[model samples]
Target: MDKNEFLTVDEIIELTGFKKQSCQCEALTANGFSYAKDAEGRPKLTWTHVNAVLNGQINVVAYENERPNFGAI
Candidate 1:
């Protein structure tokens, strides 16, 4: 990834299909996600963080129906 490319809280929300309270913002609050400040001191997340959450490393699945769509793997 390029240094200019980074994920925002909103983008991570869309990619992970998680509610703001349950994802990035919460991660930031709980210190579960990786992030840094922008020039304005706003939080910034990375694709790596999104992927980790999506892959269940952080175990954010709140509902059984929302578990990963894994097939026969």
Candidate 2:
């Protein structure tokens, strides 16, 4: 897999073993992988994110972005 390339739909299907987009998305989400739908509604994920999730490392920026900061409290 190229560093700059997003995982192709075939790759996603091979990984998740689902031919349907919805199932693929759910599988990816359930596994803590972050992805966006392409113009064709296929899940698109980066190799970096996949490796991070597989290696037990969360994407820090994404994790931080999902929480509310209460610094002023």
| Highest-TM-score candidate | 2
Q: How do the predictions measure up, each by TM-score?
A: 0.43, 0.72
* Clash numbers, per candidate: 0, 0
Q: What is the lDDT of candidate 1?
A: 0.60
lDDT of 2: 0.83
Can you write out model 2's per-residue Cα lDDT over 1-73, one digit (the tens) per residue? 7756788778999988899999999988777777989899999998888888888788655775786668857
Off by over 4 Å in 1: 3-5, 12-27, 58-73
Model 1 TM-score (2 dp): 0.43
Go through the candidates in order and give each one's C-alpha lDDT. Answer: 0.60, 0.83
Give the alpha carbon lDDT tens digit for every residue of 1-73 in model 1.
7765787556756644565444545556454455676675556777777577667776643533465668947
